[model samples]
Target: MITSPIWLPATLFAGAVQAWRTALQKRVSQNLSVNAAGLVRYLYGLPFAFLMLGLYQWAFAPSAFPALGRLFPLFCAAGGLAQIIATNLLLMAFNHRNFVVGTAYSKTEAVQGAILSFLLLGETLSALSWVGILCGVAGVMILSTGGKRMEPADFVRALGKPSALCGIASGLFFALTAIGIRRATQEVATPDHIRAALIVLCCTITMQTVMQGVWLFWREREQVSRIFLTWRSSGQVGFLASLGSACWFTGFATAPVALVRIVGQVEVIFTLAFSHFYLREKMRGSEVSGLLLIAMGVILALAGTMR
Candidate 1:
């Protein structure tokens, strides 16, 4: 088992940044196509990612750059592609129904990630951790369903809907993206987790930018110009995206992906805070219940990590 103190704080920071970054992305999406909005994070974040890699290497890495194994590029490519697809699917899902449902469905990434990490990377979570993940999933579902008490049949029927299917598929691909990043980090020659993460981040963002750039150029050339025209908002999205990604990559490098993901579910709480405070929304009874469950889940997951 990998034990590192850094992953906890890294994950917390990532979750907070991700909540804001997502909010920003939503605003930017109103002006651009799903693909174009998705590209904003990578294309604008590319420079920041490079800057992070350069600064970290100059300050902390060995005089020579660390060597990446053959699998590194392959893994980065796979991970980038999965993230791209997952993001676009998620954006599509947002348009189909209430934002609550889409957000709740996509939160399935925590549980799916744990399962995938176990199957693909041979990582295992304790029974308590499994329960915690389930609790988190339940909380997310409840929050998304507007905290309504649902009959078993109602729940089953809801899952069969296209919005749920899209959300679930997005979750699956996101799980794959996390696994790919963790595997790629393992292939780095350096033992410094931060450096390894930065290296992976730099490469992955570059590839994503290129892949998405080509698609946008070919299919939506006009949108490309519009994207730059709204650079003020898109630039903020890119900066936050890179910062959030750096934190996420560091968490992946330092601990099991499942554990990192479980801890990262705190993003929901962050979202709740934003909704209540920033949006001047009153907290509902159900929102409070969902919050408590998510908190309990995070606590239990942390406890399991000690075993």
Candidate 2:
């Protein structure tokens, strides 16, 4: 009986893996359109998602294959499409700024999730949790400014920039995606969290792959060919994405979507480290402060969950 908030570790793992996946997807975006690069995560991950399902069935539950409920497909489709839209918007933002900054904007997903979950799922956050969510949002705002100091007017102006708008829009869609997936997982008829996660994951990935594939086939065949030509990188993106998504779905099933996403904001720290070290990007004092704030927010969120 593991009962010490399993969603905590699951969210942590998802955050780390997602940082890697997002970095890879950013690289993939260099060669493909934002939509095409976003599609690669689904198209390549479809097989690995199925493999994960097979392993779960074979190793974890040999005889229990839970059938999908009537509402599962609707929830899954909504989540899948929302994620695709969010990814495309995020990748498009990547075109305008550094990797960490581009992703930092989308970190607003945590704050957005808090609102959406409350309205849609009747979920409420503790006072400390609200503080944590606000801290996380503050951190993202600081980071998204790319260390540039600005006047109040300039700060307001920055929010109106195209990349900033994309990032904010991505956050909103991602919030919806998280809520939809949580709903889908709850609709499952199984007690096994792993099985439920895998089922939802396989269905969601398949839906995304088909939807993106058909769109690309008609509108961007050359990009489709480029995806295959760059299979090695695309495969890395797919594997990391599948692994991260499995963890995310499991976390979503176990906890409130807002909490899961708030904890997942730790990905910005991971992305910051990746950008500084691997991507050889320089970090500024403001960015460092933002990272520290994010760390504090994550700690506060976890502490709230413990209450």
Task: Give the alpha carbon lDDT tens digit for every residue of 1-307 in model 1.
Answer: 5756888899999999999999998899899988898899999999999988888788656557889899999999999999999988787777786455665778889889988888888898899988888887777777776866666566557686777788889999999999999888888998788888888999999999999999999999989888898899999999999999999999998888877887887898999999999989999999899888888888888898778
RMSD of each: 1.7, 2.8
lDDT at residue 111 of model 1 (Cα atoms): 88
The lDDT per prediction is 0.87, 0.85
Q: Which candidate number would show the highest TM-score if scored against the true structure?
A: 1
Cα deviation in Å at residue 45, candidate 1? 0.3
Task: Kindly report which residue pairs in candidate 2 clash with one another.
Answer: none
TM match of model 1 to true structure: 0.95
TM per prediction: 0.95, 0.90
Query: Which residue pairs does candidate 1 place in steric collision?
Result: none
Flag regions of model 2 displaced more than 4 Å.
Answer: 1-4, 93-105, 157-162, 275-282
Candidate topping lDDT: 1
